[model samples]
Target: MAQGSGGNVIAAICNLFFPGLGQLVQGRIIAALIFAIIVVGGYALWWLVIPAIIAGVFHLWSIIDAARFKASD
Candidate 1:
């Protein structure tokens, strides 16, 4: 397994801009899609400004977690 620490770091940075961005960076299409929907839905429900922010934080966390992925040889 390749070391994806860099990708994860990048994803975390992107999460600050938008939720689900980290997942996209990590190649987690499904997770990214789900998070995207949640982000969108949050916005739909009264602009979801606060929830969006929270999601952004969580997204970053996910990215960090992905970065910790150690490849097993």
Candidate 2:
């Protein structure tokens, strides 16, 4: 139904704002933590442009991955 898909949409939007937030919402603690670390840690050295680009990739990947996730019943 539309309601179930709505949740996934919201999760994707959440991920758009913060890489790991959607995973956290879905109770994917480890995955969320890893994403958070990758994104945040990447920015830790803001002077390096490469890490920032990699972080951007991770951010987009998070959004797509969250949208595609289907919770098992």
Per-candidate TM-scores read 0.58, 0.85
Residues 31-68, candidate 1: write the lDDT tens digits.
77877776656555546478867665555565565556
lDDT scores for all predictions?
0.65, 0.82
| Over 4 Å off, model 1 | 1-4, 47-73
Q: How many residue pairs clash in all the candidates, one count each? A: 0, 0
1-73: candidate 2 lDDT, tens digit per residue: 1324887788788988888998888888898888889998887866899998898888888888788887666
Identify the candidate with maximal TM-score. Answer: 2
User: What TM-score does candidate 1 reach?
Assistant: 0.58
